[model samples]
Target: MIARAASALLVASWLVVGPTPAAQAAPATATCTSSVGPGIPPPAGLAAGVPGFHAQWYGQSGYPTLCPGERSTATVAYYNSGSRGWVNGRMGEVAYLGTWGPEPGQDQVTPLGGDGTNGSPATGWPRYNRIAIQPAPYVGPSQVAWFQFTIQAPVQAGSYRLYLRPLVEGATWLEDFGVFWLVTVLNADGTPPSPPAPPVLGTGYGFQNVATARGTFGVHLVKERLADVTVKTLTANTTECLNNCPAKPLAQYAAETNAYAGMNGTYLCPPDYAACAGKVNSYDYAVYNSTLRRWLNYNALNGQNGLLAFNGTTTSVYRRSFVYFQQQTPVTAAITNYPLLLQNGAVISSEAEQSASQLAKGTKGAIGVDGTYVYLVIATNANVTDLAYVMQALGARDGLNLDGGGTAAMWIGGSYKVGPGRLLPNAIVLTKP
Candidate 1:
């Protein structure tokens, strides 16, 4: 099931196209079989032994990025490869696309659709769990049907996936074609929403007191020419894991790599949260593991997150996209994070869509670069916006926000300066070559 699903996603990635306008509403009903034409090839790789009802994926519209409460049209095409004909509104014969995957069941209700009371992003779906049905009343074998639907992005800013499969209501599910859509939600200005608050700082951690124009911050900072230190991203696991993943403290990461300085890497699903039960400690950002010479969660490299990379002594900061970095080679270290705090020495973190925790005074962490020098900082009693000012005050040309709250931590010269806070799955480390 996993292999087939991956293959389907790979195919979809190649055929992505820009969003099209919402399709016109279909007439009450129509005969679609007559539209079948000659020279059309049969779909390849139909599931065997499921002659009664089967489907072959044809094509789908491009994935879209939307703001909260915004809506967009989406379409998917499929070829009927089964022996039976689909009849509209007929029990045991009507074909419909239902939510599936990321789980142990099918026909699950997705938050992207349904009545407003069901935590749906928007209303007007055929049903909470149903995405769409074939536009025509009957679809004969070898005929292709187009399914159109609307997707409303949720209020939260993050990437969301909706898995779908075709089935005849009250009958067996069709072939597992492994179809899904990836939607990204950001603020109206295209900035990431503020993250959740970090845990309160514990006493006795050593930090340099620095006062900036924005506010005072207790910081664990390092200023070194790139040539003097090799920066690398280290991970506890060699590969990705959804839950029960290996994680270790900042000191352990520093010791293992002989790193002189280190800090937490990215936002993650913490084990303590009830919502993280099935996927504890799983993070979705891309990070290149220097020791392994590979990217974990590599698929996320194509997203709109902020990326910081080091190619030997050359450091590059990407504010919104990783396409350019994707083509670069020989990168010694790399990590992606959200809501780029500073760009070109100017504050850029958005105040829009900031949660109460993000706006409230709390601990915040960030990594930044100025000229040939790099910096690691953990500020006290601050907000996301304050981090930008702090980075600017530190003379950073560009900066990116790291994981904060309980996940915030930093180590320097064989000991922790900010935290031995929470265990980390990944960390950015600096070591002498």
Candidate 2:
């Protein structure tokens, strides 16, 4: 968890085009037949013997944070609810697994076809060794055919999804019901992308991306040099921001602050708790701006650790704060948020579970500073530890994680590079010069 335990401190903090045939649902015990007709249909009474296979993926098993071309093992359990038995290399009856993907992130990407990012062409199929067996044949229904496959990830630096399905090679895909695991493949090359240059917008802020052997980073730079930063906030207030709606859109925050660019702010009293989120929620949220009034979370105590940095937009020694500003300088715009990610070039402890993406990865929103430039990062696919590493490599001497999943969002140049699914309660806005 990049969220550090603060004694008292600021806390803060895609799809591919596919045949729109309905993605069907089948229980582990349900006998499912292929909706997509098979090249070879079962004959006579043999039709009843055709296998009904289903799969479930447990990503934490062997899926690692891999780079393009890196080989990793994936564990999958198959369930059979048919009268036939699965045999390895048994011609048409062998039930094996195969994977291929344009990956999910591609749907969100603006493909530069000439640069190998063509969306129409089927790509991202790893050179997989044929496994013509199901480890063991099943004699009855409701049996699990568990097996593992070692395959390589695509050679790219972005989010990806490996679509896995059970198949009989030449027969047909185990369509309708299958799993696609999201992956974050960092660049094999150690090159950070050049700063973003808007086509026509005069917003001085730079919206760019960097890729490396680590992963990809979508960076929103406030300035070229160590420009001073003034953090802005939008708490619940009836007169401002569309009645200070439970969650304001990211663009709304940018417009109100006249921000050149910005991303969603600290996590709020989620709307799912609508009974408590609207006007009468009292969940001791903490902040140390001294300029704002917030419910106290025991004035920032132990065990509550998640912190980013103050004086972010400057070239200075990285200092972390918990109960007090470690630098002794008064924190002008600080929030009581936590698990500080980086401090003076060292990575703060981060746990895998902090990011609750079932596959160990998902959308991420973060704030970081390399002591010279403050950066706002939004990742459509990645875990917390991976995100922290990407920020650290970007020269972030001090960094912190922010709310992610559905609440993560980013807007620049009057457009959302990555829009949110719902409104946001607060945001970290960048006032452009």
Candidate 3:
């Protein structure tokens, strides 16, 4: 009788009203489970032969699996080898790409890893499954595979789950699988996205409405904009404004407010790097500083604004014009006592070694500060209201419109906030004192 009733409900749910609510609802009690078995081990001592890699299932333990538009209920973790041997000189780094469903197609993903880097190893090898003429030779005696994906609540208002397994020699390698780590994605930020609508601001060259100044506003910090400026040298005791224009000369420096001629003033760039700077489209970038233990960016609130927090210090917090950002790993690592950087967004020539288009047009992703909290946004078919809400809910006290239309991105700042090392034209910087 219960089975018949369930079948009737299923049929009525499918035919009579909208979609099936039960089908869309997340599983109330789900657990992630897995087992492991030994396989042909690595030959011996070579770093490549180390047993750091293992097969594991994510979310097999009890947790809510997530998808876009679904509230984050669980956080899952995967681990690499215990030591550094798992990482190669520059070739053996982790790479990831997202998808709508567990199918073999690059529908939403880009041809390359968003940028030209291709995220290929030293010998043009991908860390996970590869699609080419033939499988790239795995010279090492052993090989490990990793898979990652996330689900957001607003993207789809339905309960969803994903199953991950390894593929070997065109076959499913389920027996050798083992369980590794698992974490939970939670609603740390109580806010949710508002439905979509037209953008609050317009698409113009100059910005007229600066962030509200009525309240105690923090210093106006712009990500690095490549612009020209007048240079002046001041004496130790002379705390006066001094300006030396390229052609004309003056002894007084312009005040921060005066820098803008007036509302709709012509966009300006700093006199540092000669790349296009000033008033980029809606977007912002933040870099995680391990030493300072905070997210760092150009602080426009300070009086003297030259690389405000460059060279291992966060004291310089002023000298911003607009904002820009690049995507990077969630944590920071050290090579020469300096953080390891990479490209994860848009590709522009002036961006230096950074990939100019790491997070460019129409792409959607999430960002979090402390590992326990996170916020995800959907670019495609998402309204500005919803976007604003999600960001705020995720602890973005003050956030800006990152380049969207696929260029949107976020990195989990569990350890170090990944940084794309170029100045964006416009960015929304956070101001939490």
Candidate 4:
């Protein structure tokens, strides 16, 4: 009786275990079939590769042409050809798009990632080398996953390529579908649709309403080569102006100096303001008259103000306190203004000590040099800080903020490109010798 009962128990155990392996193997076989259902189909042009954690390139959005320092959205689609499902936020199962190729390059850093010391082109990336991840929570076999990310073009204009490949992070990289994004970065123009022509040697006028990550600004400028022109400061008064100072329109200053281009000078007390009741049209900054070959307000040169000087052969921008330049450099023309904008290709202006007027958004003027050329700029609807970025965009190695607001003005090629906004006690002019 004990043997019969044991045999019956053994038979019952077989009944339970007999179908378990087939049931398990059935799903495993289906997992490798490469098809999800009747309506689901494998991606076109899909090639057989890795059995698990594999991906097939499906499609992507059109490549974009971006301006330097501009951001744009991009999307890439990948069909899961692997046996496993991509699980979001899972260490081993999560899939990511990583920088790849140029041969032997896998997970390489790219300028599009903005991970370098220069700064990011786009923000909110998973990692410096990781581009993006599957947007859905799970991407099963034969399903498509669309990964979206933002790309910020580098501040240089050129064709940029980012080779990309999918990988199951912490597991294995997927097939080398050999995909890449070819992005074109154009020259700086506010809404730049195409690459601008090469910068010419002579003066030219244009309005640059640029769009940046910070905001948009409208800047009018006169660009010229320092080698082709002489840069000088022309003051209406022969000496320093205290009160009831003589001021002239920008056109007159340009006419008298035979200047091809000109802009307003350093900050001053305008007659329109009640604060300038006694000091109407008065300014205390130091300026060198090229016509007279003497420095105006020479005593004020000891203060902490940015100095821009030209010695007929080269241009120089002194950050603050030009005592050394005054004593050593025999500059033909020099002018002093508060708050240097850029130094050595970097924005150095701080709004900490700025007055409310200086901090406000209005017309702002600046003078900048890129070692090869000089730029006289007038930015509308911008502040001191914004002017710094504008100068940087103009490729200025060093820049200085000049007087602006209603006093802002710029004359180029015998016409006012920006303003004749208000009369100026002094002006910076570009003349052909």
TM-score, one value per model: 0.51, 0.49, 0.20, 0.54
Model 4's TM-score against the true structure: 0.54
* Root-mean-square deviation (CA) per prediction: 18.1, 16.4, 21.8, 24.0
- CA deviation > 4 Å runs, candidate 4: 1-203, 322-327
lDDT tens digits by residue: candidate 3, 92-193: 322122222122122232221122234321212133223211112221223332222222233322222232222232222211121211112223232222
**Please, what's the RMSD in Å of model 3?**
21.8
Cα displacement (angstroms), candidate 3, residue 6, comes to 39
Least lDDT summed over 10 consecutive residues: which range in candidate 2? 37-46
Who wins the lDDT comparison?
Answer: 4
Ranking by TM-score: 4, 1, 2, 3
TM-score of decoy 3: 0.20
Residue-level lDDT of model 2, residues 49-108, one tens digit each, is 233533222222322344444444344444453444555556766765554222323123
The global C-alpha lDDT for each of the candidates, from Candidate 1 onward, is 0.68, 0.45, 0.22, 0.70
Residue 373 lDDT (model 2): 68
Task: Name the TM-score of candidate 2.
Answer: 0.49
Clashing residue pairs, candidate 4?
Answer: 114-120, 190-209
Ranking by lDDT: 4, 1, 2, 3
Q: Residue 81 in candidate 4 has what lDDT?
A: 66
Error of 4 at 251 (Å): 0.5
Write the residue-wise lDDT of candidate 4 on 1-433 in tens digits: 0011110111111122111111211122221211111111222244322356776665555556665655555666676766788898999999989886541146766787634433444455687778887777788876777676666666776667676778899998775433556666655542333544443334577765554444445567788888888988978888777899999899999898888889999898776554677997888888889999998888878888888778885877777756544565788888889888998898985788676656655568899888888889887656688889878877778899898855778888888765576689889998998
